[model samples]
Target: MLIHHHKTLCVCDFTTLLELSQPKISRHLAQLREHGIVSDSRKGRWVYYSLNNQLPDWCQRVINETYQASQTELAELLNKSLTSESCCE
Candidate 1:
């Protein structure tokens, strides 16, 4: 999920990237939101999530490092978002 650093992602994006069920994704996202690691905004019927910039510097640094380390996988996951199909309405 750290791959979402500095970017907004819809639940569909996470579902596609993780190949997980919506309920599972929502559960995890709820946990992240609870911990102040991620935040969400409504765009129509969809909600997009991004890393919470207000997080501690150390937390941001860790997310950045993890994102950097997973660049290849992240790129592949991002490519999926370019498709016309997604879990969103």
Candidate 2:
């Protein structure tokens, strides 16, 4: 969903969007960061994550395609993210 929206999101946002705990979200994001799949930036107390633009074209294509294929199921989560307020605020 982050790839689809092309926006940065914080752990709190993922907690809200995915209905998961903050630690779980943070752990997954940390792993993604370690793998170079995502990049993070610290903004005050919040760390926001976005897809790594430096990814190879083939990797980008795969992520884009996966997002496309899952769009139907992800529609609700995407909508929720847009409409919901970030806890960071």
Winning candidate number (lDDT): 2
Question: Stretches of candidate 1 above 4 Å error?
Answer: 1-6, 79-81
TM-score of each: 0.80, 0.88
For each of the candidates, the C-alpha root-mean-square deviation to the true structure, in angstroms, is 2.2, 1.6
The regions of model 2 sitting more than 4 angstroms off are none
C-alpha RMSD (angstroms) for model 2: 1.6
> Taking the tens digit of each residue's C-alpha lDDT, what string does model 2 give over 1-89?
65457478878877877889999988988899999999989889888899998999999999888988887888877777444456787
Alpha carbon lDDT at 88, candidate 1: 70
lDDT score of residue 63 within candidate 2? 85
* Clashes (candidate 2): 0
State the C-alpha lDDT per candidate.
Answer: 0.77, 0.81
Query: What lDDT is reached at residue 76 by model 1?
Result: 71
Give the per-residue lDDT digits (tens) of candidate 1, residues 2-86: 3364387787777787688889988989999999988899989999888887999898788778878988877776665535676
